[model samples]
Target: MKSILLCFGLLFISFLSPDISAVRADYRSASENQEEAEKLYTELASVSDTDEVLLLGYKGATATLMAKYAKGVSAKTAYFKEGKGLIEQAISTAPDNIELRYIRLSVQENAPKIVRYHKEIDEDKQFILDHYPNLKDGETKKYIKGFVSQSASFSEAEKQLF
Candidate 1:
């Protein structure tokens, strides 16, 4: 019986082990840890388990961040354009993915006005508001709620939903 119990415990741990290292949570700390962003992006790009759309979105986000650190105009332009292209593909692949929309929203909020990347800001916000309640992941809902609470883009009533 003890051996059987040990086997079950090991199985349980194994089941949870993948989630511990999945790409979904891997990039969540990128904002706070920019130094690791490039490595994380490289590692994530090599992963096949994650949804391709989500992976592409994060890859684009990472490229955008890298663009900020680029030393030359040509390098910066290349990274930014590549990132934008990857994000556009992700959006096209999963138009209704709220998480992807949130990623895009965050990007647009901080992007320069001259870039004209704000076109989807309102649409993404509305989509997030409408779909937030239906999200199944409690942790993600909490993250979104925290984000909304501090975001200038969301109105008072809109923040109340999260």
Candidate 2:
């Protein structure tokens, strides 16, 4: 119990860095790897009270990834529901955050058809593309472009524009 408490304490402390680049990389990595998902979930699950939109977005994305790996239907639904709620809250809090929109687009693009999370795929894709050139952050623009280039949601011509 002591060790568990200490580990939990340490994990919460790790979130204080608010490193956007780390979270961005983790978002991409955790989306494709179960081990990365577990690590990200562990790191963010204890820090929900944070007002940081990027942190919250990554937390939500990690939750959805964990939902895919969860053992049962109920568990999967619970994870998805919680994660979706966090994501929606974060977007509602920061509608202009391109990173948050990209997070949503990724989730929606890959979400099960039955879950109906794809409503904003086009909107987000267009928003990212239209704003790509004007975005001040080169790394973020590159990340968004990279994802868009590979996204099935975008047309062949649209993908090439990036």
Candidate 3:
């Protein structure tokens, strides 16, 4: 009877272990980082091109950091969307900027596992094909093909631009 009581006490203690506290702390940090990233994104959006190119670079870096944290939290879908939007906006303001394209591709490559928006992907592919179609086929292209084939949205879009 004493052994049984001791065993129950140990089990209860294990259930209230420190690991849970550490996990909660990690979650809180991720949440705080996400909020900071959102703020930086908002500030970047409001800034004009008259600002130094370095400012845009800083914003992109901040966005990427936020995305990394979001991915860690398994909130990747939201992170990718937000990161993509920020990069796209920056690119539009600085069309000749090569760094923007690299940042955009980085976000795309790291995008979390989710239902692919086939229409949007297809439009991007077609645009590339129309201009740089001659580019050699690669693994990324193959993966995208598979995604489009599997995605229901791809079928529903039926050539419509996303």
lDDT of 2 by residue, 16-122 (tens): 75577877888788888999899988877665645578788888888999998899999999899888888899998988889889999999888998777878888
Candidate 3 RMSD to the correct structure: 17.6
TM-score preference between candidates 1 and 3, better one: 1
lDDT of 2: 0.85
lDDT of 1: 0.74
TM-score of 3: 0.35
- TM-score: the better of candidates 1 and 2: 2
Please state the error at residue 104 of candidate 1 in Å.
0.5
Decide which is better by lDDT, 1 or 3: 1
The residue pairs in collision within model 1 are none
TM-score of each: 0.77, 0.86, 0.35
Stretches off by above 4 angstroms in model 3 are 1-50, 57-61, 71-78, 113-162
Model 3: per-residue lDDT, tens digit, 1-162? 999999999898665432422332332243357765555555555444455443554355455556666545457556555545555667678654433443344344344455242223444434433433232535334433443344433344532321
lDDT pick, better of 2 and 3? 2
Candidates in order have lDDT scores of: 0.74, 0.85, 0.46
Q: Write the per-residue lDDT of candidate 1 for residues 1-162, one digit (tens) a residue.
A: 999999999898555433422544556566556666676666655533244567778778777766766689888788778777888888888898888888888777867676677898999999999999899988778767776787889989878778
For model 2, name the residue pairs that clash. Answer: none
CA lDDT, candidate 1, residue 78: 83
What TM-score does candidate 1 reach? Answer: 0.77
